[model samples]
Target: MAGPSYLVNILDSNHVSAPKGSVPSTTLALTYLDLPWFPSAPMQSLFFYEFPHPISHFMQTTLPTLTQSLSLTLQHFFPLAAKLICPPPPLKPFILYSDGDSVPLIVAEFTGADVDHLTANYPRDFKLLHPFVPELPPSTMSSDGILVMPIMAVKVTVFPNTGVCIGMAHNHVAADGSAFMHFMRSWSSVCKSKGDSTFLDEESRRPFYNRDAFGDPDGCNEEALKCYWHWISSWRENLAGPTKEISSVDKVRATFVLTRAQITKLKQWLTTQCKNSSNDSEEVKISTFVVTCSIMWICMIKSQENDIQVSTNGDDDDDDDTFYYLLFAVDCRNRIGFSLPVTYFGNCLAPGIIRAKKSELMGAKGIVTAGKAIAKKVKEMESGALKEAEKGPSNLEEMFRSGHHVAISGSPKFRVYDMDFGWGRPLKIEFIHIDDGGSLSLIESKNESGGMEVSLVLSKNQMDAFTSNLAESLKAF
Candidate 1:
């Protein structure tokens, strides 16, 4: 029942390690915290495409396109290269394509021997909730990013198993998750096509990797943001909850996907019903992710109630009735207000919060209310007109202290979408085991049949719910 000892150690490391610079130059900073004690869980071992057909070909044609894009991108954001620690030789890494234009392919190769160790943890280690993001229950860890660096003692006896961690740690600094995907798509096209991507129009690509989002000017009164940060930062301490208990609580986490078809339809339907003014010039904006999250949050919260009434939730006997925050990661690296040149990389994401009382969530519009809150939070984040996750200095870590309890998470979106390291096109793309603080990571998977295939790690019950939803989705799609 005790989680790995490394858990506390790594978490502590992130809290105290301030950025080398007291002031974060860019809106984001990615520091390598030594995981003296990383949360130990299931270790995955899988192969991309063993036979290796067009992988080399894919890499040869597409690597330059990506590297070139990254190089040009870095010139925009000066410190990006140092963050990723890219070798001077500028090694051209490979990328993978996704099932659709939305997903990505990651190739993670591991030794077969390690399979036993991973299998032992299986659903538990892989699906358990994150220890730090206590509101999320255990399963949230699965969907978020993972931390895998053996205790430095136990050597994972796996062979031939490997995986790709997020590569943006290097070039393409300002590419938001969306733009990153765009770049990946281009790489995939080059890998799958007969034409050359070497001639891509540099101007055609949108400007991303900018550093101004953090300090962008918008309606957010600096006083208001500072106040909110102080209030919210203090509030986070009480909500972290007790130790992670994987068994009873329903695992609550988040996911990011395009508006896709079905969810988009649902949003449109809801738009017609909302009494809110359609008068806004931006139009009635909604997305599949919003709709899906609304529905899921409703179900999880409502599942606690015998009826839709809020008070009824407290009387419920079920153990899974606990309510966890459904936090969505948004990348502010590219929002319009950001003035920093493209190529700024690091963790340029912010968490969108939708809080729900255990019982009130069962109300008919509970999910809808939560969804709106999510949208509203996102709006608040980009108050400066830049689509940043929050309104604050890029380097908030400068103020970090040992006793300070802060919750941060982000979406490493669209990283390996079109990576082609000259080995044909990468048959797979997956981020390596990476852990910073309380972070939830989602990366593309390697599936021959195409479509999106992802591997998430979460706590127990939350993992159960997540898997249940995933299975349902697989069937529905």
Candidate 2:
């Protein structure tokens, strides 16, 4: 049966406001977290919110309010209105803000689909969400061949009586998930307060953009940049362009809700397993993030057993030579001591990797091993991991190109459900192009209660097996 689909009409497209008149152009140097995304892959997200009012009321009343509120909100976030400027060598990349600059705000409407089906937990055609996402401006190269791209673009689509979805595509170098959420929360706050700027909190009103604030005591930014350029140069052949579009993938996307009780059970089971293990020195500090991520990682790997068997050409199925890695990213705002504001906007994340052999992952201690690896990485972050990244050698290219990688995007800590743009909280929030490239989005469930919505894209067969394994494993817990 054909899944739901829709056509998007680009009703309006224009830029939002930025700092004008006598305000000197603001330039923010790229930090370590920002450098990796230099060539820029715009991360897109769709937030589905239920609107009780009729379509006319929304188009007439609500749309104007949202538009105005977003404009007012953007006034404070001028960088979103700006473009990334990378001059010729000897000049580092920075955000350039000038008068009349604005973010591209697109209003689109989608039709010919069932809204209920679109919002459901069951697997659906990932292509259905593509039209809602506005395309980012293509990257431009200077006469000297330095590349720069648009920082952000936004689209808001309506589904008649069903609901509305706000689609956003932003440069990762410009803002990490935390910074992005801060902007979004601020926009919603403005909308909820009837465009009252006064009601906004300090975090929203004042996002520290000082790139110098992060005391790169060990010159992590330079080291990271060097490592990044090296990786890019090596992968230049594969970097030509995206090989496949969203429609080319025969994949399904599903959002599985894991309640707090289920996650707690999983963690407890891991803790008990660790205690019974031979390694008494290991501390069982399995957190909700670690436990949930570990479970998903396990399920994903287990579900691919058939593929592994086929690829190995009848080699030992239990081969310890095969590689498996769980690539996760962490926000370093709090870990940097007192240098940067917790609300400091812009990229503040560094990647963390935990790898194991395929045999180890398929073993009984799989969950415990994965959990411990994550715990160790977390501890490392607490003890100057960011600073150490400068001196340590980088595997950025290898890790990215490795077929064994399963990365985590977004976070459960963001409380995305709390965002209310005057209508109500979102019914569902999912990454649009997650299927194009494989990555797991871990976000707080919309229920307000403690839980996680694990959203990912996998081929049809793998998705079915993954879902089945996920259910069975959680049931066992």
Candidate 3:
């Protein structure tokens, strides 16, 4: 499958536009939302272990298996993801979230390369992957006015031992993390089961994220839904305050395991700290995992210097002491209005945010406050769920008036554990950068040996601080 392969291509001029819909006309801003909002756009982190160690058999090829077709089996379960878009989702609708006139989907492209091709041929070290022509043709697009593609067509390259990585980027309006993972697995499952025809039948199109389980289109008022739109608009601009795009070395990834005793002590400490505190009626229970993250970031910053630094890589930039710490993700199965069970279809549900500054999060009390703050914000998301989004924000527009400054974004949506293509869980789950930004994920589960562990994937510099600070922070209580 080399030069001009048998793939569909949907060029912008040849494609149709999103069909007219009833959704609202107002642009939405994540910061403007009345309640705390998650991704201004729907995004996710997917983890996969290097093909489980059967050591005897493993190889990486662009197209792993010689199926009848070169296009991914993704066409099987998530054709929407890998196909091209004709009529793109309108740009204004996403203004609240993306902050730009262009759709993130069309702005990005997917090009595949063998890991060896990258290590040996590329002029640059294996740091980034760029866009290229798409294969899907014009037929895949819909007439809708929105340029929403269930799946973004991507070229997949194999990593001899690491398995295949299929690049996917879509309109943030369409899918979130959980939705993306379900889509990713469903897409790959079809590929692995090439011999089997029953994997993703028409029945699989059940609308997992909507009230209906089938391919039924939802009937909520599109304009009324902007209530959801305007709310997030305010959250981004108003309550969250302005975003600052500080520059720093890329944060890296790391993993650490803790004893049940260590986990318990940390949890106890946080609970006790919240005891006398008067915040919300909701119990101050904390996920041991969230505590680990706060500790991770604090240690991350401390190891670097007495205070965190924030520079936007600008030659004329001022003040270098601004930094923010992010907490992991939470499942929105219940958070969103969709009451359907967490199903195995296109992505469903959404997430909320948990952020703190470097100075405030330096010491023990600081970590506790940061973690607790995350819990509180998520809890707000729990109680209000969709309603909060309808309320909108008073101070929202000011935040993203300019397109810069988003600090550490964290997510703990680990779906690698739930997916099983018959080969049991893989040995290691790692995330490759598909998006430009600082991202951190926290997982709470047993490792390959059934022991507790905390794994972090972040920018390179953050990794150094995290390791040194973690060693000391872990010793503290």
Using TM-score as the measure, which candidate wins? 2
lDDT of 3 at 108: 20
Q: Which pairs in model 2 have colliding backbones?
A: 16-103
Q: TM-score for every candidate vs. truth?
A: 0.44, 0.91, 0.57
**Per-residue lDDT of candidate 3, residues 148-167 (tens digit):** 22334343333434443334
Q: What is the lDDT of residue 266 in candidate 3?
A: 79
- Residue 217 displacement in candidate 3 (angstroms): 18
For candidate 3, the lDDT comes to 0.40
RMSD of each: 13.7, 3.0, 10.6
lDDT of 3 at 265: 82
For candidate 2, which ten residues in a row score worst on lDDT?
235-244
Error of 2 at 457 (Å): 0.2
Output the better candidate (2/3) by lDDT: 2
Model 2 misplaced stretches (Cα beyond 4 Å): 1-5, 19-24, 141-148, 199-205, 227-247, 278-282, 310-318, 336-338, 391-393
Number of colliding residue pairs in model 2: 1
Off by more than 4 A, model 1: 1-110, 113-265, 268-284, 295-324, 333-336, 340-351, 363-365, 377-415, 424-455, 469-477
